[model samples]
Target: MFGLFKRRPKTPGVARLEPLGVDVTVPVNQSVLQAALEAGVDFPHSCKVGTCMACRSRLVEGKVKAIRDFSYVLSAEELKAGYILACQAKLAPGDRIVLEVDIDSQRPHFPQLTCDGRITAQTALTHDIVELRVAVDQPLQYAAGQYATLRPAHIERAREYSFAAAPTPGGDNELRFFIRKTPGGQFTGWLFEQSRVGETLELTGPGGDFWLRAAEAPLVFVAGGSGLAPVLSVLEDAARAGVARDAVFLFGARTQQDLYQVDAIEAIAGRWAAQFRFVPVLSHEPADSDWTGARGLVTDYLAAPHVPDLAASHAYLCGPPPMIDAALAVLAAAGVADGHVHYDKFLDASNLAG
Candidate 1:
């Protein structure tokens, strides 16, 4: 009878973050990143999935059970150095853990804000892409290229989308996003199938570390599908700041119809103090179409006789995992340093499941 009353083994259920000196509870089945966000740790992260390595941190002390394989995104050196993605880490039968995080000090940390937002407008940009403009009840402040997590009342899980433009100074009450509809996506399916313009949404955010860095080097922007959101935001912020660095934007799409925001991009280029070029590469455009622009994959045009020298440029890339991988290979071969390349990989439920 006493055996039935024996106590269960205890887990520390605690994660001690270094540098910031914050301690947060890690509940069973909850990731370390989620716990930190709940405790207001201001951890840098995007795409809560394991794809974007933004939530990576050093596991200084303690073992963690990873939900996914880290070999895909993290390098062998990083793995050897004990770096782990907080979004995929869970307490693994251990005591308290000590983690070293690199929180960006360049910009002031904006506390995670939660507010009710109403969909003010919905404009279809492509066959599967939609631009959603939301007006929130309170002011929200965030750096350009950051993303927000939005959930409609009917959806069980919220999805993250990058801000499609720079925010108004002194915190703006309106937010905008470009969302691509995933065929089986719960949120995107609902958004595309119904008129959600007047519907209220639960919004939380201003998350992510995919912002523009201060540099004098020329900029190389590569984007695919709806991944152009943050790229556009960064360029807008640069234009507003009067930073006249030469830039070349290589945008990729399947067909001519997949291209969007052309006039808007041209407007940005119009005010560019230095040289600016926008190249749209269509991978599968019809052979009979009068498309005189660049054809084939965007990676094919990265070499000379195609685009200018990229050896001294800073590159920003965003897209599906495959596209990002291909672009990274091309960029590396073109002499672009590893540190100069920043990227965000968009992942859906299928990726999370994997």
Candidate 2:
């Protein structure tokens, strides 16, 4: 429907998906993601519109044609990185292609321990995102800024997601996640439509080295969409530890409708009002709205006249690749040492790629 994909092959072809170890025939009429679903081999995917790149896979072998703008999600830099959006690619008829679901799985130090959990609650945080609370059977001992891999009960392939909150006061039986429901995505579509409380989901890990470093310097946090998950985790944990150093959190969204959990964030930030700042930026808001907040890309806010000094602080960013890249450029220009900044860029299959 997006008209972003080229004509698919009329004949079926073989595709071997790694990690999940699924080898299925992809019908020429259907996308690779669809084929996986048909075979009951749930694969990582978001917008089947070919916009989100949630179904991104690495071509280990074979040939194909992928039509993408390279300006949206898929880009020349990503192509060079050996990743292709499966939803946008047309497989050569009768040919076989081998692919790996994720690149990080190849890393030795990465621990991907599968854990079990049951949905305790699912709340609509906004028109697009939902806040899911899962009670795990076992504690997921991890750093505040780390993430995990999530696989819905019906999904065969697991997607990565970050922790939205720090561990509970007494134990780690419960975990939280803020998820965006991408249109045309099977997993999120079911999540927003048919999923129910008590639904069990398989979880894995305490992945990523992006956790908070020692709170020695001031901090700047930049987030986009559910990227707020891990940043909020770090902040909440810091607040509990009474480690309120001067900090600023700048969140960006396309419009007011895209923003969520504002009141909850404001409430938590109230504890450190003297040292913590929360600024939400809307890039495309209607002029008629009564909203009178910062308007533009978050990077613009970092460069604004009244912004505080960032050169002496540590910066943490979690969001789409484009926003992360832009924020890095802005921070560097503001004299924030490259080593002083930490970030978790969401180019993984976990993203709701619309």
Candidate 3:
């Protein structure tokens, strides 16, 4: 080996900050938030997982790289305006930036920790859908419409499920999840066949930034399969808060048997019938059955005459990517503002592997 000069720590990745006029340097490989924290600057962060855009800031001078995986939610114009998520961005040397501290301070914090929980109850909502109730060792506070990662002990695999249960009054320790069996999914197979009451499992909490925000706009919920989880959570949370805004939930399935939680939706509608409506859409039901509700694709229902004023309503969608794509187009065509349409696409890696 040839003798060579050693590399210096100040070579490149170090961030040279010019915060509010004061200049300083930070190490490379650290996110903007981490750099701020190390520099004694307070920055707001939640889910530190790059999913929440709460830590967004402006990249005034140098380039920054995103640290975590994320799907872009901001438009091209926003990026052109220098807005970038600090949690996902790594600053390079010579980067001069001004932090939007007010926006960052509003993000809610979620602790990252693994805990053990026991399966208290499990039930089949439909032929292939299962509802699980677990009691964790400690209380976990999470916003409705978020999700958790479930990993069985000694198992190398994990699954993500949305929270369907409403947050207990004053918050509680029990966690609820709604899971649908994907044809041959590894975790789903194990869950369907071997998961039983009293079985212990490991889970990571309160993931996802898809929770509801405070707004007076009317809301529409569209979902299919277990995508109904987060949608149901939003609706229940809204009803619990006594929100009087008009809301409609359009749940779709292949046939009558594929539908789950109809009664649950009906119950919520009955309680908030004055401002809420539940419509079940069947895509491939038998003609013999006397179905009086909406029929055909869920997108069709959204295009119907009874749809609320799109300009003042917010739309929430959760389902397969194809359905979400179509729903977005339909909503846009119906005059819904692009910024008001929020969605979470359920893409299973196992499905891709097959």
Candidate 4:
């Protein structure tokens, strides 16, 4: 075989995002995410400031470094596993590098649009959570469980929140979100402490791949805390579509006080009695306590006796990363198809500020 010309480094560098199968140029001054987006690489992203973990990717082969750490969203083990926030990592100028983009989930192609939205109402859902209803200037085209990014005035980076109600996928202009106040986070702190209704936020995107997919099997939804947002949205969507598929929702909380929107959910379950069931689980309440219902981790309900023929079900998971991680194990043990199980792992802002 004839020898090819000796390989040499070029003046500029390139990167590859796989699974999606895309290649793009990377500049020393710009992050890999910025370069990839300019080159049209489709991936999940929110809080472009590197806190959301939406643009997380693993370094497969080449050299890239992060300007800021995302320890809150990614555990130390994951960091060692080659995960890097694409929005924060960049290649050295004139350096050769290869990258393995870690995109574990998929979403339908929807052009992300940035628009103006006004808060129509802000009602407390729990001691620390609020239901923020917004009316966008123009209708957003999104699936029931998708999320939108809000760029609050005082915050430099945008925050991602999943829709809590299902408006028409391509027709509705109103957006609902369940927001929990993070103790020391940027956006949440500002929203809880200083923000008000009748205010405007720059909304962008309808990101995420956590919506309910078409499946013949029954739907089992496991949600914790504010993670109920997308679950509720999807359930409403299913009801609106007149889907007769059986659905069981297991909502977990530390105590009964943490649970919200019970009447609303119960109403839906009652109206769709033949097809829907709602079960609220408490993790901290004792057997002697006043609450009488399912208790313990949300996964407890999936254990053998409670559910029969779990293998024939499609499971949807949403909540904090810890809950999502644990539920994944149970779902796996239950024999749900990898493709039939969809999830959205929530991450809170932690130690991102200077």
Once all C-alphas are superposed, what RMSD does model 4 give against the true structure?
A: 8.0
Candidates ranked by TM-score: 1, 3, 4, 2
Clashes of 3: 0
Q: CA shift at 57, candidate 4, in angstroms?
A: 9.7
- Candidate 1: segments with Cα more than 4 A from true spot: 1-12, 349-354
Model 4: number of backbone collisions: 0
Which one is best on lDDT? 1
Pairs of residues at least 3 apart in sequence or in different chains that clash in candidate 1: none
lDDT of 2 at 244: 57
- In model 2, which regions exceed 4 Å deviation? 1-112, 169-171, 304-306, 348-354
The lDDT, on a scale of 0 to 1, for candidate 1 is 0.86
Ten contiguous residues minimizing lDDT sum, candidate 3: 99-108
Q: Which pairs in model 4 have colliding backbones? A: none
TM-score of 3: 0.78
CA shift of 256, model 1, Å:
1.8
Q: TM-score winner among the candidates?
A: 1
Per-residue CA lDDT of model 2 for 250-310, tens digit only, reads 9998888888878767866887635778899999888788889989888788754435877
Ranking of predictions according to lDDT: 1, 4, 2, 3
